[model samples]
Target: MSQLHALAAAAGVARTWQDADGRDQVVSDDALAAVLAALGYQADDDDAASASVAALSEEMSRPPAFLSVDIDAPLALPASLAAAEAAELTMEQGERRSLPIVRGVLPPIAEPGYHRLQIGEHALVLAVAPPRCLLPADLPGVARKRLWGTAIQIPSLHERPAPYGTFADLREAVRLFAARGADAVAISPVHALLSGGTSFYPYSPSSRLFLNAMLVDTSTADAGLSDQKEQELIDWPSGLASRQRELRRAFADLTPEQRQEIDAWSERQGSALHRQAVFDALSLHLDERDWRKWPADYAHPEAPGIAGFATEQTEEIAFHLFAQWLAERSLAAVQGEAKSGGMAIGLIADLAVGIDPAGSDAWALQGTMLTGLTIGAPPDPLGPDGQNWALTGFSPQDLRQSGFAPWIATLRAALRHAGGVRIDHAFGLARLWVVPEGRLASEGAYLSYPFADMLRIIALESHRAGAVVIGEDLGTRPPGFVEPVTDKGILGMRVLWFERNGNGFAPAEDFPAQAIAMTGTHDTATVAGWWTGRDIGWNRRLARGNWHNEETQRMADRSALWSAIGSGTPQPSADTPAPVVEAAIVQMGRTPSVLAIIPLEDLLGLEEQPNLPGTIDEHPNWRRRLSGPLADLLAEPATARRLAALIEARRA
Candidate 1:
C-alpha cells in the first residue's frame, strides 16, 4: 500500500468502497487527507504522516479507560494488563468479586452494568451488556404476537389557537390511539431546535440531550396573551415568539418556593444541562446563531469568559433551565397518560442520526464531536450528486477514549419518556460518510466507528430503560450489518413502498418476524399521495426528477400494490386514492412482523406527506396540522373504518 493509503487504513478511513450501482469507487487522495486532518492527523507529507502514525501507535499502546462486552462472554485483556493474575470487580449494585484471570481471559460476568475492574494499579470500567434489547415478546403484559401502532408528527395535532401542538394535545392523542387497540404512538423527534427561527425541521436539532421547549403546554401559564385563529399550518416564528413570551411571564410569576424547586431539579441534571443552559442564553444575548462566530473566549463551554457570562446572564440562563424543566414534565405526562390508558409500549421516540453543526450538542460536547466535517450519503439513484445533511457526529476515537459517554447520554435522553426509540439512519453506528468542509458530498469517505462496543452499549441502555429498540436500517447498509443488529434484538424497519418482489409488491408474510412493518415514514410519500402521483407533481415543479417517467411507473406500481393486497382486487385510479390508502394500512397490519405502524397521514387518507425530501421551503414540510381535534379525529367515517380494519388484520 502507498504511504497515504496505509495511514488512512490505520485511521479507519475507507480507501475504496462499493457504490449503489455495484461499482467500485475509490476515495480521492484529497478527500482522505481532509478527513484525516479532521480526525487530528497531519497527512500532507510523508514525514508528517509517519509522525502521525507514530502518535497513533503510541495512543493505541495506552489502555482504554473502559471495556464493553456481552454478558457471559470472555474478554481478552489488553496486552499491558495481561500479566495480572487476578482482578477485583465491583458491581454497580455495590457488590464486589475477586476473579482469577486465566491466560489473560477474564471470567464472564453474569450481570449487566457498569462494573469496576482493578488489576494491579490500573483501573477501568467494564460495561457488561445483555445479549439483546427488550423485545415486544419480552415486554410484560404484552401477550399478542403482532402489535400495531400509529405514527404522527407532534406539531400536526394542533387543534387550539396556539398555532402549534403541545404535550397536552399529545396526551389526548395517546388516549385516542390506545382506545383503538394501538400499543404505540410513534412521533417525530422532539429534540431541541433553533428557537424563533423560520425553519422548524425536527431532525436538525440544536441538542438531543434536551427536549424542545417550544412544545411545552403553556395553557396554565397563559399570561393573558392574545390568541390567534387555529390554522392548517403552524406559523413557527410567531408561535415560538408567543411561547417565549408566555414562558417568560410564567417565570416572572414563580414564587420563591417554585424557584427553589426548579433550582434543585436543575442541579440534578449535572454539567451537561448547565452547558446547554449557558449555550441557549449566550446565543440569545449575543444575537448570534452559530457559536463559532462568537468572540473567541465565549465560544467554548468551559472557556474563561464563559464564567463571567453565566454570572451576568443568570436570569436569562435560569429562564432556559426553567423552560427545559417544563418541557420534560409535559412530555412525561403524555407518556404517563399512554401507559395509564392501557398501552403496552407507548410513545416510540425518534432519534435523529446527527445534530446541526451549529447546535448546542456540538458546542457542549466538543470533546467528542467532530469539527469541520459534515455527515451525509454518497451518490445514490435518488441523489445523483450525493447529499450533504450538514450535520455533525461523534468522533470514533473520542468515543472509545471517553468511554462512550456522549452516546450513552443521547440514548438515555431519547428513552427517558418513551417506551421505545427508533434510531434514524442507524447505519451511522457502524460507519458514517463524512465530507470535509468546502468539499462536494461526492468527495466523502466512510469513517469506521467502534460498532461492536457501541451496539453493546445500546443493549445495555435498552435493558436499563426497559425500552424496545428499532433501527432505521433502510438505505444501503454495510456488509454483514443486519445479522448483528438482529442478534442484538434491535428491530429493523420494513417500509411498504420498498418491499418489492420482482416487478410487484411483496406479500405481507414475506417480511421478517423480527422486524417492524410500516406503511410509510415521514420522509416518504403517503399512501394517498403515492396512489395519485402527488410526489411526481412536486418533483416536476421543483425539477427534482423526470416527472414523465415517474408518472408512468406510478401507474404500474398502483396495479402491483393492488394485486399484492388481495387477489382479484381492482386497482384504484389516481382520482380515487382513499380505497388504496385503506387497503395499504390493512395490508401492512397483516404482516407477520412484530409491529405494524401506519402514519396518521395515511390513516386519514391525506394526500400530502409530512415532509418532502430535498426541499427546504418549496414544500410545506413539518408545518401541516391535522384537520380536527384528536378526540374527534375518529369521527371521520373513512378513518374509523381503516383503523378498525387494522385491528382486525393484526388479529389475523
Candidate 2:
C-alpha cells in the first residue's frame, strides 16, 4: 500500500469498495487525501502521511472507557488496574464486592448490565451483556407467534389529538390501534430537529437524546391559534415558531411550585440539559439558526461565558427546558397509555443514524464528534450520484476515548419512552461512509466502527429496558454481520419489496422469523402508490440523469410483485391498484417475521410517501397527512376490511 493508503487504513477507511452493481470501485488518491483531511488528518505529502499514521495508531492503541464481555466471559484489564492492592466491583444493581484479579484477567461475570470495576483511581465500566437480546415474543400480551403494528408519522396524524395530531393525538390513535389488537405502534423518529428549516423530516434530527417539542399538542379550550386545516403538509419553520409560542404561554403561566420543579428537573438533567438550554438561548439571543455562526464565546458549550449566560438569561433557558419537559411528559403519557391498554410493546421509536453538524448535539458533544466529515453513502443503484445525508456522527476514535457514553445515552433516550427501537441505517454499526465537508457523496470511503462493542451496548440497554431491538439492515451489510446480529437477538428488517427470490420477491411464508416485516418504510412509496406506479412518476419528476429511465422496468417490477404476492390480479396498470393493495398488505402480514409494521400511508392508501431519499424540497417529504381525521380514516369501510384481512393473515 502507498503511504496515503496506509494512513487511510490506519484511520479505518476502506481503500477499495464495490458499488451496488457488483462492480469493483477504488477510492482515488485525490478522494483519499480529501477524506483524510476531513478526518482532521493532513496527508498532502509522504511526511504528513507517516505522521498521521503514527498519531492515529497511538490513539487506536489507547485503552477504552469500557469493555463489553459476554456473560461468563473473562474480562482482561490493564496491569495498572489489575495490580492494584484494593479493587471493587459494582454491579448494575447497587451490589458491590471486592475483586481478586489474577494476571490482569478478572473472573467471569455471571449477570448482564453495567458493572463498575475500580482499582483505586484506575476504574472502568465493564458492560456485561446477555449472549443475545430479547425477542419480540418475550414481551407480554403477544400471544400470537407473529406481532403486528402500524407505523405512523405521529405529527401528520389527525383527530387523534382533536386538532392536529400531536403526541396527545398519537396516544388516542394508539388506544384505537390497541383496541384493534395491534401490539406495537412504530413511530417515526421524534428526535429533536433543527427548528428553523423543514425539520418535519424525522431522519435528520438535531439530537438523538431529546424529542421534538414542536410536535407536542398545543390546542386549548380557548382559541390560542386557529386550527391549521390548510393542507396535509406542514411548513416546519413556521410550525416550530408557532408551537414554541404556545410553549411560551404555558411556561409564562407556570406556578411557583411548577417553576421550582422545572428548575429541579433542569438540575437533574445536569450539564447536558443545561448545555442544550444554553445553546437554545444563545441561538435565540443571537437570532441565528446555525450555532457555527454564533459569536465565538457562545459557540462552545463548555466556554466559561455559557454558564454565565444561562444565569443572566434565565427565562430563555427555562423556556427550552420547559419545552423538553413537555415533550417528555407527553411521551411518557403515551407509553403509559400503551401499557395500560394491554399492548405487548406500546411504542417502537425510530433512532436516526446521526445528528446535524450545526445543531445542539454537535455543540454539546463536540469532543465525541468528528469536526470536518459528514456521513454519506457511496453511489449505488438507489441513487446513481450517491447520498450525502449531511449529518454529523460520532468519531469512532472519540467513541472509544469517551468509553461509548454518548452511544449508551442515545440508546437509553430513545428506548426510554418506547418498548422497542428501530435503528435507521443499521449498517452504520459496522461501518460508515464518510465524505469531506465539500465533497460529493461519491467521493466518500468506508470507515469501520466497533461493531461488537456497540452491539453489546445495544443488547445491554435493550435487556435492561425489557425492549425488543430491530436493525434496519436493509442495504449492504458487512459480510457475516447478520449472523451475529441475529445471535445477539436483534431482529433485522425485511421489506416486502426487498424480500426477493431470484429477481423476484420471496413468498410470505419464506420471510425470516428473526426480522421485522413491513409493507414499506418512510422512504419508500406507500402500497397504493407503489402498485399504481405513482412512485415511478415521483421518481421521474425528481430523479436526475439516468436514474429515472427504469420506469418501464419499475412497472414490470410491480407486476412481478403482484404475482409473487399471489394476488391473482391481472398485471394492474395505473388505472387500478386496489386489488394489489389488499393482497400486498395481506402478504406482508402473513410473513414469518415476528413483527409486521404497516405504514399509516399504506393503511390509508395515500399516494405520496413521507420521504423520498434523494429529493429534498422537490418532493413534499414528511409533510403528507393521512386522509381526514384518524377516527374517520380508520372507520372507512375499505380500511376496516383491510385490517380484518391483515389480522386474519397474522392469526393464520
Best by TM-score: 1
| Model 2 agreement with the true structure over 59-150: per-residue lDDT tens digits | 66655567788999887776435565556889879899886777878788898888887777667788888888888777765655687889
Per-candidate TM-score against the hidden true structure: 0.98, 0.94
Across 343-404, the per-residue lDDT of candidate 1 in tens digits comes to 88899999999999888999888979999899999999988888999999999999887878
Local distance difference test, per candidate?
0.88, 0.81
* C-alpha RMSD by candidate, in order: 1.5, 2.5
Q: How far does residue 550 in candidate 2 sit from its true spot (Å)?
A: 3.1
With candidate 2 superimposed using the best TM-score fit, by how many Å does residue 14's alpha carbon deviate from the native? 1.5
